[model samples]
Target: MSAARPARLAVGVVSAGRVGAVLGAALSAIGHRVVATAAVSKASLHRAETLLPGVPVLPPDEVALHADLVLLAVPDDVLPGMVRGLAAAGAFRPGQILVHTAGAHGISVLEPAVEHGVLPLALHPVLTFTGRSEDVQRLTGACIAVTAREDDEVAWSVGEALVLELSAEPVRVPEQARPLYHAALAHGANHLVTLVRDCAELLQREVLVATSTGSTDESMVGSASSTSAERVIGPLLSAALDNALRHGDRALTGPVARGDVGTLRTHLRELDRVDPELADIYRVLARRTAHRAVAGGLLPDHAAAEVRATLEEHR
Candidate 1:
């Protein structure tokens, strides 16, 4: 394949999942044809229709047998067995490009397919996919982690070429580093969602208290203002996220960073009354935040010690 553009190969997506269908659409946009896909779930079938229209839905073996490039976008746990099963079924042929999107795995998991003389590559797009057209658009600036045999420059170039064709940058990741790379991404992206949702839930509770009328349930809060909590916090959260990305540890702020031990105690008591689990989570995160603040010079060691003491006393 050329560095500027990949050849228009016949592509087969092993399954029309959130990641698979959107990637298929990206490949198709760049002149490659999506020949076949396997989709069993209703959502998958709908995604195939929406993102990869005109592509035939076939069994996994048939999809692999018919394509020059096979994209295995299955879950991490399912990928190894699926590759082995396809190789055993004689579906993978010589000269076929076998690719997987599992972030934790490198080309090692493709060993079974490699035994069949197929060129194995791992191309994991770092962004989350929703099996939508917008997801294909998101690929334009997203980073894809490319892992091929360290000895094979041609294979590495091929993976890089494919990512470039989608207008995305490719970062070369060594096989041994794949697990840690994926873990870091998960810790940032996945945990960020959980953290944001927890914050939103807490804000919603306060919204309920501030806006209650004759009724005091959550429905009353919704009736008063459906998006009041989100409206109040969205811009602040967005700015904090942007600042954190741009400034790293220097972006630390709020009561924990200031070592407001009295404020921390009040928060813990309120959270403990409302939800013990949430209180525990807040305590743990606040303790860590205080440490980071101190290390970043936002808080003095004496202040951080006081914050930690307050958290432990609350526990």
Candidate 2:
């Protein structure tokens, strides 16, 4: 029955990539037997050795053949071909549980394996992974996007149950919405990394320049400035993120939100002088932020017009 927890499954991970290795370990933690994993490349092999000690590393087809639950954790583009290739190889069996970790795909991509009568489900963990042991702990309280056939309640339950077994919350995503869902996550999480890194690099450059006047060795200065930059920005970025989450656009602050055109001009000039590309990025994002500030009623029409004019001047 759908309400029942999955019986202990012989789990087979198709590859020990970051997502695969971590999810395999999570399933193992929940008492599933990780019979084997397919890991190629030095990194993947090392990940398997570290995260899944004693598990046999085999080829993809062999791994699938050895398990009752086969996890396909390959890239989104590789997923369809892998599924079809495995199915053609007769690696999937009837009544087997076939799951993929590709966020952009739903059960549809598993159709080839489904033709073999496997129970197809898409269980995409919403967390980024580093293929490390700590990732297993991060699974707790994380959201996993679960997608099953619209009419298949049993499949839905199975997907959610698997997420629960990993100590994660399951959020149902309609098959049609997977692409947009994945895009939204990528836009936020991936772009946030770029944004944070840019900020850190700029801060580090400034710190290095300021500290260079001292007798400190160049390498030592660089190292110290990098750490100092992180220390300076960490709490500020954390609070900004927390406030944005809690207060929505009302959390908007700083020059853009205040519609301080003079301050905006200064930022544009500084960035353009030091990092022209970053200045271009700032202009684009500041334009968007200004729009949001106005929508949030934080900026008046006159002030927003001035801000827009200043940005255009910098462009």
In TM-score terms, candidate 1 sits at: 0.94
Candidate 2 achieves a global lDDT of 0.92
- Candidate-wise lDDT, in order: 0.91, 0.92
Error of 1 at 273 (Å): 0.8
Per-residue lDDT, model 1, residue 56, is 97
lDDT of 1: 0.91
List model 1 lDDT by residue over 172-274, tens digit each.
Answer: 9999999999999999999889888888788777654466553667686567765566676789889999999999878999889998888888899899998
Cα TM-score per model? 0.94, 0.94
Cα lDDT tens digits for candidate 2, 173-202: 999999999999999999999999999899
- Name the 10 consecutive residues with the lowest summed lDDT in model 1: 207-216
